[model samples]
Target: MAAARRRNSHVQRQRACADSLAEFVERSPSSFHAAAAVADHLASAGFARVEERDEWPAEPGDYVLLRDGAVVAWRIPEEIDDTAPFAIVGAHTDSPGFRLKPSPDRVAHGWRQLAVEVYGGPLLNSWLDRELRLAGRVSLTDGSTRLVQTGAIARIPQLAVHLDRQVNSEGLKLDPQLHTAPVTGPENGPDARSIIAAAAGVEAEDLVAWDLALADTQAPAFLGSDETMLAAGRLDNLVSVHAAMRAIVDTVPSGVIPVIAAFDHEEVGSGTRSGAAGPLLEQVIDRIQDARAVSPSHRARALGASWCVSSDVGHSIHPNYPERHDDGARPIAGGGPILKVNANQRYASDARGAALWAGVCSNAGVTTQPFVSRNSIPCGSTIGPITATRLGVSTVDVGIPILSMHSAREVCAIADAHALERALAVFLAGGWPEHA
Candidate 1:
């Protein structure tokens, strides 16, 4: 009976994680919304807000910082010293999609369309014929901003099969300049900005400028025979964001400080002010050290002792295209979390880091898999290497294995969400023997 109850409890936890992830993605349509949602979650968990312009406090407590489209939240133990190391989980809040331009009013042949630029590397063809919604922050003439979401307001229709008879054999080829624009309405219909203004509860004339993106209107759903898989948009990085947030919220405090660094602009090489390559994480860490009045030498030592888990999604093996993956290291969808390693340094996971992560998973009673891109195909990079190089800290790259990454929608095992969260919670709880 006890064994059965334990198994049932595990299943319940997994279901809870999956349900929470679905709600999180539904609430976060753009990076700005994602950051805002994260901030709200932290606030509900009793984390106090800290503004960049204000002086920080030395007393240990839960605090959060928010940038334009980024958020950093940390927990300081009541009894912390200069030698205390930070246990950081790094994730990105942004995903690949289309961003609306400043002057988006365009009419082609009686059809009103919105001018948009590709924000990151996306599977352009996947966006064709999908209903799209606009969501983001809109700046008003009064210097105030409001969030907006116009549901199912636009669509990018694909060329009919009759027009492109050989499309199936030739494969769909799209030109960003010509084929990627989404039609919003007829020439005589309402202007795009007006629609956005209405959704934001403001007048069109009161809108000074706006930052917006096109997002999928389809709601996330569970798939597979047993409904064991989740299909959703923006799963690549948002999954990591949600997992890291849950870990921090659920884990009890220990000697080490647990931090979540969810940055924006990672989809475009992370070069912006709110991105991982920028000064956000470094600035926050410096301020923490300053607030605690740690000596320079002690700060350096603490940093050297710190470790980061760079959480991002990796590719799961596709049965139809088995050759695309490494023969020895293809991860399956239903498997537990994956440890991504690239000898070329695309990922920062070295032998030591890998071992550390493996130990953490073991302690959590969660299985793990390995992922390495085929040598013939070049691997992609993540925030792991960037954080390690910039902060001089040891880092490991880890994530839930996913399929259809960078597409209008993506897929992953529902169980893996709980697995990744459990492992991260263990790490945050100081499961690492060496660190302990």
Candidate 2:
């Protein structure tokens, strides 16, 4: 009876975690919104929001730094010193989608459309026939940026099956320039700028430029017989982002500092100023050290002793395409979180990192598995290698297994996501025997 009660308790906790994750994803339609959402979660948990130009608090406490669409949050232990190591949880805020192009209003065949540039490698076929929401930050003439998210106002309708009967067998083909433009309404309707400005509660003329994306209008839901499956948009990385945010918010730092780095532009190769490849994470680390009166040399020692868990979604063994995965690399949904491995440095995970993850998961009482892509199918990379190379931190890549990774909507096991959260919480709290 005790074992059964424990199982019931775990199920309830996992369900609650899934619900919380869904709420996080629903509020984050774009990278900017994701950053704000993370900030909100951290602030609610007593983290002070520190600006880049302002001085960070030197005393030990929880702090968060927001940089445009990216955010770097940390927890400083009461006994933190110059040589204190950091257990960092890194994830990206951006996902594969269509970005609204400048002067995006278009008219063709008496139909008004919005021109959108492909931001990342999205499954184009899944985006068709779905209502899309316009979301992102718009720059105003007053030199301020405001996030705007309009309701379902546009759609990329696919060619009817009667017109293209061969689509099922031959596969649907989409042209990003021609066929991917989302139709809004009749050509006589309001322009894109006007509608977007209205959403931002500003006049059209006041809005100068913007960074917008078209997001799926569908809200995340729990599916499957027992409601253990999570279906949502942006699960490719938002799941990891929410996990990191929740973990850091609840963690009380021990000997090591806990940092959550959610950067933008990961899907576009993380080249932007707020991306993992840029100076945001590095600068945040240095700033934290500087505020604590740590010298550059001591900071280097801390960096060398630090560990980063690069969290992103990994592929699950698809039922219809089992051949795409290796024989032993059968990462399944509902099993647990995955430790992504790539021998060619595509992933940052090494033997030592794996052991570190094993120890963390063991302490957290969460089961974990391994994931490696087949030899023929090249594995995609995330912010892991970038963070490892840029900061010289011992990094390990880990994430929950999911299906339809870059689709308009993705699915994952709720238990897996919850397991990831539990493990991340343990890692952020310095559950690994020692800080180093």
Count of clashing pairs, candidate 2: 0
RMSD of each: 1.1, 1.1
Residue pairs in candidate 2 whose N, alpha carbon or C atoms collide under 3 angstroms: none
lDDT of each: 0.92, 0.92
Q: Model 1: which ten-residue window has the lowest total lDDT?
A: 427-436
lDDT tens digits, residues 1-436, model 1? 9999998898888888999999999999999999999999989999999999999989988999999889999998888878888999999999998999999888999999989999889999889899999998899999888788888989999999999999999898899989999998889988887888899998889998888999999999999677889999999899999998889998885768899999999999998889999999999999999999999999999998888999999999999999999999989988999999998999999999989999999999999999999989988899999999999999999998999999999999988998999999998877885733
lDDT of 2 by residue, 81-165 (tens): 7887899999999999899998899999999999899988999989999999999999999999999999999999999999999
Report the C-alpha displacement of residue 417, candidate 2, in angstroms. Answer: 0.8
